[model samples]
Target chain A: MADEAEIFSQLKQAVMEGDEDVAVAAAQAAVAAGVDPQRAIIEGLAAGMAEMGRLYEREECYVPELLVSSEALYAGLGVLRPLVIASGKAEKKGVAVIGVVQGDIHDIGKNLVKMMLEVNGIEVHDLGRDVDMERFITATQETQADLLCLSALMTTTMIAIKDYMPAFKTQLPGVKIMVGGAPLNQQLADEWGADGYGENAVEAARVAVRLLETK
Target chain B: MHRDHSVKGKWVKCDQMTSQERWEALVNRRPTDRVPCLQFMLGHTAVVNGRPIAKIYDDGAESLACQRNAMALYGHDGLIMHGWANAGGAEFGGEIEFPYRKYTGAPLMKKNPVQSEEDAWDLRVPDDILSVGTMPIALEFSRLQYEAGLTVTLQVGSPLTWAGSVYGEERLMIWMLKKPELVHHVLRVITDFIRRKADYWIDRFGAERLMAFDLGIETNKLYSPKQFETFGFPYLREIHDHLTERGTAIILSHICGEQNKNLPLWARLSYGKRGMVSVGKEVAISKAREMFPDCVIMGNVDPVTVQEGTPEQVRMLCRACIEEGKDHPGGFALMTGCEVPPQAPPVNVDQMVKACRELGRY
Candidate 1:
């Protein structure tokens, strides 16, 4: 079995290379080698992603690099995802169902948010665009997830968060919902009846974890 | 930027004119005397300059200031703001996580928020466009701008864009293939809402004060011209006609795309009849002029030219836009096909405007 140090390095290498296949293979190997899946995910992939994000923010990397690296992270998750489940290891500290709100199609930002969370070892169920009220509720029920994260990019569509919460509790009272997006924030989140708000991708995961810890 | 912009020449007061009167002059290929240059007056740009993004949307006064700033900056003969960036389809009713990015400190609605067709059906246009959320606050801000005697421009929903907001771009694209009826339904809702909201603002600001597009195409076409005509045009025409009836002479139809399949149809629409096609570079504005001689056109200069190119390059480009457009004062408006990149060096923008003013024989 390899030490956490070795596996982390390999996982970082795969992600930096933007090789999704290699990232996934390495992540699987990491888990198989007795490195904790969650640690490998959070520390290994997420760290590399953070660097990528920083580079992106700095203009060192553009869209293609960010996208390719995200894909690599996706591949890493794919490999490690099943093991956490098969072993009933509870790999995800908590699950989050996230999506862009209705009346909005913009997703690059949402995808980034999702990937960032996933790399942090949150079980992210992406409810792709224009998700209905029921599906949002149903996904929560199905996953018995810790958090429901909603994203609305459009000023027009963001208002739907108003309806979602009422429906969410009326349907399932215990589920916690966090809504975030470009046009929204902690204040708007509270106004919209969301339990909490995350200002950005990194914050979303941190918030998601905190939400679950309380749960 | 040269520390002082002494706009020493002539500054006209457009306040006395009613919305309808202003609309008529600009829409019918009449010379409004000045181009409409509404740069980042409100919405995202407002958020950029004003208080934090969260507060700008929340505060009525701040939103107004943003709008006024945009108007002041460009002081175009017209103003255009057809819509705003949302968190995504999911927040409204789709699936997305539109975070207020801390790094860039901007907001966005990502694409592919909707996960399925059923989700699309389950959605409706929320009334909050005017009443709830920051939108109503924005409308109130526009009202304040009008009350304060500012020339007005606003945005409305384009069917395709509205559909994209609800269904997610990917799903909407698939809907174009699988369930176009659903796509049309979504479009109808957004179009109707936009029209209704336009009417609301028209009641306040009066219809047709300033010209702006519905921003029919964002980065370019994901739809063919035929599809746009078949699906998008009818709605656009209806809105334009409705606005026209209410005294809106020009409903600028905006597009920034590679394929112009829908452009000719967009050109023919009554609102866009003498109206400007805010075309970005990939499409030939000159060819568009030949195809639709009466239609006004704006933009095609690459941001590179403005951001990095010399004043000479900007001058040359603006000259081309004017020369190719052949209708600057009357039938043409000069502008970036998309919003001027916010970070664009102000000098290039100044150059573009200067060239626009100088190139005209009028």
Candidate 2:
């Protein structure tokens, strides 16, 4: 049997290669070897995702590569999440409610941000795309979410973010609002009163972590 | 209202060139008063007209009015009668949502028709797919715009983009990796349908008068240059060959995101000598002009800046773009990297026109 370090490395390699079966097999083997779930996740899966994120930022990898890697990571997570919870070793950084804002069905960016957040150990409630403003408020209230991440690919749908800011502030005053997408910039985020702006998925996860730390 | 032209610091009556003449002059690299300004401003036009986006998409008359009013307001050289998003996919049984009030949001696919590899076999290109859905409305709008003496550009997605719409993008991504042959099958079907649709339009509207804006070639952002070369270029070549053979003077190619790696392949297009390519914000116009010296480079202005910035800022950006490509031997057109936002300030658009007339002078 391989040692914990070797098993962990194999898991990481699986994720980086975007091979779901290998990731799951390596994860299950690590669990059977009595390797800590948190260690397996952070040192193995999350580490691989971090590398993938770097590749994406450097343009070495594109959206399809990221998508496949995330899918692999989730497959491993599927086999390990309940185990981690049962072991009582799961440490969630924060609870996040993320969605592509009202009238926008473009969710690729939002989906990427969610995957990054999840890999970073944030429990994310994905509201999917074209989400209504009221659903965002309700999800925040129900989940007591620490972060509300809104995404819009189109400039027209982005208006929904601005329209809902006052309402989000009034209703969910403590919730931090994060905005991101192709058309978004830091200046626009400031204009829309977003608590934070993420230019891309990796940056979005970093911003989420920062928002949680400050909270 | 004839705008004054400042040629070498002298105010002169700008030659009243029809939109078509201006486009032709730029394409032919002839001496012109100034660089032409063409915008992908369909959603912005809907906002200017204060019309529901759904109504404009579904009703030809409303779309015509919106396009006409936008030209009247912005004094642009051309107009695009953009139809519902994913109209072809919708015609093939992809469920679509047509929401009102969202000018930028058109009829988007609510459900993809091709769920699995086997589903590709079930898909068929209806004979009247072009006339079905909101396409007829768009065609009618184009006809009206043409009749009104305006240069009408028709925007349609590439086969790969249409395939992604027909089969969900995620599924298509997976297929690209796990089932490439399946992706090829779907792409071939979509290419056939798109080719027929282009032929239909070209036959109805003289190819010289109608410019087919083939979009979605930027799959390079999602796939590698090789993947695009394999799946994207063939269909694009087919359409290009078919259209050019029928005398389509200008075929506008727009790839939404960074396409730096695919620039070489794009330069190899059959009509590269006379066609136009619109690059995204990630590509510099100077670089595109340097690379595709034969093709007319259309744009690189940041649409986000136009949407949120002041008129002065927009003018500054427009001036910068003009300065970058004003001397390119193939010629350049001032345009947004992507569609101008519906809520972009009219003052900013006015400033773009002003910048083109001022700094774009030869």
Candidate 3:
């Protein structure tokens, strides 16, 4: 049987190459070898995703690569996450509620951010695309989420973020708000009373972690 | 570029050319009085006219009227057209929702036409392209432009962007890696559909009078240059070659978002008699000028700044863009990097024209 380090390297390579079968096999080997599932996730699966995030930032890889790597990461996670829970070592960094705002169905950016957040060990409640303001408020309250990340790709739909801001402040007083998308900038996020803003998904996860640390 | 003339015993750059005259001069490669401000706006026009945003997408006559009124109000030069970036889904058999409700901007694709591999294989260009969804509205809008002697506009896809609408963007993107052949098949169908649509438009309105444009969102932020070369460039080249060969006089490509990496590829496409390229803020106007030195460089102004920023800020950005782009040999027009946000302050929108008038004079 391969050693733990070799198995971990295999898992990371599988994710980087977007090979789900290899990732699954490596994860099962890690499981059979009595390697901690959580360690395998953190050192193998999440590490691979984090590398993809870096590659994405450097433009060495693009969204398609990130999407594929995400599938591999999830495939590995599908094997290991339940084991981690059964081992009673599933500690989340924080909870996050994420969605594309109402009137905008474009969720690619939101989805990316969600995956990044999940890789960072945040329990993300993805509300999907064209999410209503009420849904966001309810999700945040119910999840008692540490952070709320909103995305809007269109100029028109971005208005929903601004319109929903005051209500979020009133209803979910302590929950930190984050906004991102192609149309948004740091200035708009500041103006809209968001606690933080990310230019891309990797940066978004970084900001979410920072915000959660403060909380 | 406008020069100072003796007005009331003072050297002042007064109104030197009408909008029509300025547009003509720019297109024909003649000297213009000053920097022309072209708007890449859509839903904002309806908002300014106190109409639902849906009017701008669903009702072509109303879209034209709203746009014209907004143009007159702002005193900007051109680019009055119908259609959004995500345009082909409805034409290809997907359901679309026009922006009638609050917070809705442009039309939204309620469902994609292709959901699975089988659907992808079955996708084809409609036999009657004109009778399909939103084609009638687009035709009516073009008819109005033709009647008014304005530039008739048509949204021809970059094929890849339309494919994003035909199949869902994420699914299409994944297919680009896992099932590239399938992706190419869909792109092929989209290109054929775009060609048929372009032919119809050219047949109806003389190619010389139409501005064939593609709103491309294949930003480097989304796709690698290689991905674009494979999926985007070939289809774009085919369409552009076809348009130029068929005597189409102009093509305005809104190379939307951060597509600096794709510039080399974009510069490779044939742009007919004249080309106009509009870029988002992530791309510098100077870079756009360098890439397409013979094509008109339209923008780099941040639309968010135009929406959320102060009038002074908008003017400053406009001034910066005009200064950078105003001297391109091909031509230049001050415009928002992307679609002007629907609820941008009126004064902020006016700031662009005001900047052109005050600082952009030659």
Strongest candidate by DockQ: 3
Candidate achieving higher lDDT, 2 or 3:
3
Ranking by TM-score: 3, 2, 1
How far off is residue A179 in model 2, in Å? 1.4
DockQ of each: 0.03, 0.55, 0.83
Model 3 C-alpha lDDT per residue in residues B1-362, reported as the tens digit of each score: 24455534856666588777889988989988889999987888988999998999999999999999998888888889988888899988899998887788888899999999999999988889888989999999999999999999989987899999999999998999999999999999999999999998999899999899999999898999999999999999999999999989899899998898899999999998989899989899889888999999998789888888899899889989988988999999999998988999999999898788877876
lDDT of 2 at B192: 78
lDDT of each residue in A1-215, candidate 1, tens digit only: 77888888878877776877779778877867888776787678778887876775554554445666777777887776666667776655778888877655556667777887776667789998767678888888898877888887544456567667788877867778888775565766776688878765656767777887888
What are the per-residue Cα lDDT tens digits for candidate 2 across A111-214? Answer: 99999999898999999998888999999999999999999977788878888899999999889999998778898899889999998899999999999999
- Cα lDDT of candidate 1 equals 0.62
Candidate 1 regions exceeding 4 Å error are: A1-215, B1-60, B70-82, B85-106, B110-115, B125-129, B132-134, B208-212, B218-221, B272-274, B308-310, B326-330
Could you give candidate 1's per-residue lDDT for residues B312-331 as a string of tens digits? 77778777776776554336
Q: RMSD to the native, candidate 3? A: 2.3
Interface RMSD of 3: 0.9
**After best superposition, candidate 3 residue B96: deviation in angstroms?**
0.9
